[model samples]
Target: MLVVYTTTLFMISLLIIDYSTYVLEYPHSFKYNMVKNK
Candidate 1:
């Protein structure tokens, strides 16, 4: 039970990290392209 709980938490954290990075990077890439065009 403990192992299962830990694994679930780890998976959740990984997903959250991935989602946050994607959110953070999306605008960054857009701005980068905008700057490149200018």
Candidate 2:
């Protein structure tokens, strides 16, 4: 149970890091896409 929790937390952290990097690298594009989707 502990191992599973740790793995899930790690995956979530990786996703957050990746998402932040993407937003930082393409802020305008990300905002544009969000507006378009809405």
Candidate 3:
């Protein structure tokens, strides 16, 4: 039971990191494109 709980917590943290990076990178890329076009 403890092992399962720890695994689930680890998975959740990984997902949060992935999602945060994606969210941050997407807007940064979009802004970069706009600047490049200008």
**TM-score, cand. 3:** 0.89
Query: What TM-score would you give candidate 2 relative to the actual structure?
Result: 0.69
lDDT of 2 by residue, 1-38 (tens): 99999999999999999999887889888888999999
Displacement of residue 10 (Cα, Å) in model 1 is 0.2
Between which residue pairs do clashes occur in model 2?
A: none
Count clashes in each candidate, considering only residues at least 3 apart in sequence or on different chains.
0, 0, 0
lDDT of 2 at 12: 100
lDDT score for residue 1 of model 3: 100
On residues 1-38, what C-alpha lDDT tens digit does candidate 3 reach at each position? 99999999999999999999999999999999999999
Which residue segments of model 2 deviate by more than 4 Å?
28-38
Q: What does candidate 1's lDDT look like per residue over 1-38, in tens digits?
A: 99999999999999999999999999999999999999
lDDT of 3: 0.99
Decide which is better by TM-score, 1 or 3.
3
